[model samples]
Target: MPLKHRFRTDAALGLVQVSPPLIYALVMLAAPLGTIVLFSFWTQDFLTIDRSFTLNNYREAVTDPLYSELLFRSLRIAGAVTAATVLLAFPIAYFVSFQVRPARKSLWLFLITIPFWTSYLIRVFLWRVILAYDGPVNGTLISLGIIDEPLSWILYNANAVVITLAHAFAPFAILPIFVSLEKIDRSLLEAARDLGESRTATFFRVTLPLAMPGVLAAILIVFIPTIGDYVTPRLVGGSGGTMIANMIQTQFMRLNNAPMGATLAVIAMLSVTLISLVLVLATRRWTRSR
Candidate 1:
């Protein structure tokens, strides 16, 4: 066969391999995104939608102080949850990666993943029960005489939202960090220690740098999804805990303003994309520098 013909055949084969995933994305992901973008520029009222193009939705979604405030608040909450999840997951991941007996590692990992077997809504409600006035947390504290009354602060608040979300996202943070930690070459740590480095120094200089990619992955996975989590905020977040997703929900459902809701969704999605890009770039540079 001529060289050009061979190259064309290979290219066609590559396209064939990619076509299924490309078509799946086009149908499932791209279609919904396109619809949202279209709706965002339109108008809606009383179960009626005007497909006519306009920037009014974007104008209100952006210029409205309420939308901006909620967007920032959502970012903050998502940031906090990301930090907490990564910090808490790191040690457990480290323990599993470096300390667990090889035979027991699977068991430990499986146990950690057990929470995923339950429905997400069920887990949220379980947190509600645990944090309720008469729940185990307050009851235990009161029985131990640690507090005079059931603490009202634990349930239906921003802190509750954070705690619940962090717990819910713990496994996501763990699995990635564990994969990263597990991939580190053990010989590198040994080499660092041979140069008279303390265990702590070796870990900081060798292990942590190698594991940073996983840490970044964990951050993006947890932060992005949690930022747009309407259910958690609605269930656990009282007025003080309402995130941008809750606002979007109110706009779409309660207000029957689909255009504004789609606009808000687009804004939220763009914010997450921007933040994730920054994180990836920053972490990539940091990893290379190390």
Candidate 2:
């Protein structure tokens, strides 16, 4: 049967629009994921990957304390980034959406995304330079007499990782929030005002509730990718700042343990997915309660 005869015009149009991306995803994403699943169950020796199946990789991944620490560290750092990104982005998003004249909103939003125009690696290194012992931060502090000497604690640690990731993901967090805020109905604020609510109260009561979806989107966008970021941690995250992705990279490249790496990848993916599901459910509950 012809597609048009089998489905209505709108349905056919929807399918047509979706099919290209779906096929591309299947080829690019699904195929690699399926391969990783297979590799996760197999064993690898010093040089050769064993075709035989085994549960040892999964066992080792769970039983090892180092993996857990790195996983937890990644989660904690990613969570901090998510919170910081959302908090910082919200004000800018709110200003652009509600306060800025419509004519210049696009320009302001374009400025938000200007960071992405630079190479990501360059940005990471730029942070390193800014936070280095004798760098601008220390130089400024010394000039202002805030400190007598350069601080050695700024660049190479978890704090640095969180700061860099939060900065890197800020635009992502902001755009979604801006989109959400822009979608809020103007009449909702009018309704709140007519009820004798103050400006702050109206925002808290009406605007926030309506903007939760965008906030949630911003959180997920920042949280999910930052947790697995290898480059940021590798560059600025000294000994104590390594995340789960760093270990996975070690397993795959340094140790020549593809199976273990694949297993770790799977575990990290599942863990992130589980946390995201819980967060989504909790947000839904909270919104419903409100």
Candidate 3:
């Protein structure tokens, strides 16, 4: 074949290979997203969906005190969940990566994923039971003389949501950090020690920096989904623990305001995108500076 013809043939073959997924993405993801965007600009009146474009939905989503409160509450809960999950996950990942025998590392990872064997709803319900007023946690605390009675604050509140979400997303945080830690070269730590750096200093200067990619990945994974979670919040979070997702759900299902629901969905998506971008840039700058 002529050189140009051969190049064209290879390009055509590549396009053919990529076409299926491209079409699938457009049909599945893009189509629904486009519909949501279109719906967000319209207005809904109980049973009627006005197709006319309007900013009233966006205006209400932004200006309404209820919406603002729920949005902020969701952000706070997601932040708490992300912080708790990542902090708890790092040490476990570090131990598994460094302390566990190579032959047993797979076993540790397998154990970490055992939670996935059960339905997510089941786990959330189990947490609900464990955190109930008469549940094991309060029972143990009372028996140990830690409290006088069952704690009402732990269940059907933000605390319960945080605890459940952190536990649920623990594996998501651990795996990425483990992958990052595994990629780190042991020689760098040895060199740092040879130069008289203390254990803590070496970890801060060398280990943490290298593992940052995985940490950042874990952060995005846990933070994004937790913010949009309605089920756990609804099950464990009373009115006090209700997040934006619950509001979105109520708008669509109970209130029959599809436009308002879409509006809230768009706002939540944009906020998540902005926060994720900021995190990525900040991590990149910090890594480069180090």
Candidate 4:
């Protein structure tokens, strides 16, 4: 074959290989998202979609006190969970990446992931037992003379929801942070140390900035899912812990408002997407500057 013909053939084959993934993305992801976007704007009559575009849903979602309250609550709780996860996961990831041998690091990673093999519902329910008024936590506290009576505030509240979600998401934070920490060149830390930097200064100047990408990724992973979580809130949130997701559920199943439910979902999705984008841009800028 002539050189020009060979180049054309290779380009054609490349296009053919790429087409499958593009088609799959359109069908699996784009199609469902398109439907959600349409449904967000469509009006509904007693659970039936009327196929009429209206701003009524958005108006209600943004203006109504009930939904607005739920949205703010969800945002606050998700924010707290994100902050807690980052603070807690960073040290574990640092230790695993920098301190442990490679073989033992793999073992620790395996241990972190192994718990996920069990049913998530079961694991969450287990927390209920542990956090209950008459549970081991209270029992141990009483035995240790920390409290005379069982703490009623320990279960079925916002605190419970945050704790449960944080535990669930800790591994997500750890893995990304660990990967980023591991990828950092050891020479960077050594150079900082050789410059007469103390351990704390070296960590702040050399380690933390390099690990920010992983921290950003972990925040995105935890915050997005925790914001949309229905099971944890319903299981342990009680009245105070009711998130926007619970409101969406009520709209769909009990109130028979599919359009409104979908609208809330879309709004939540857009919020998460915006946050993720901001983090990505910030991380890119930080990486480039560093």
TM-score of every candidate: 0.95, 0.95, 0.97, 0.93
Model 3: number of clashes? 0
Q: lDDT tens string, model 1, 1-290?
A: 88667757978779878999999999999999999999999899789898898998888878989899899989998999999999999999999999999999999999999999999999999998899989999999999999999999878888899999999999999999999999999999999989899999988888998999899999999999998998988898888889999988888889999889999999999999999999999988988888
Q: Which lDDT values do the candidates have, in the order given? A: 0.93, 0.92, 0.96, 0.90
Candidate 4, residues 1-290: lDDT per residue as tens digits?
88667757878779878999999999999998888788888877785679977989999889889888898899999999999988999999999898899879889999989869988898789989999999999999999999999998868999889888898889999999999999899998999999999999989878988888788889999998899999999998899999999999998899888889999999999888887898789887986786
lDDT of 3 by residue, 188-249 (tens): 99999999999999999999999999999999999999999999999999988999999989
The weakest ten consecutive residues by lDDT in model 4 span 3-12
Q: Judge candidate 4 at residue 177 and give its lDDT.
A: 97
Clashes of each: 0, 0, 0, 0
What are the runs in model 2 whose C-alpha is more than 4 Å off?
1-4, 7-17
Candidate 2 has its poorest 10 consecutive residues by lDDT at 3-12
Which one is best on lDDT? 3
Q: Give the Cα error of residue 232 in candidate 3, in Å.
A: 0.3
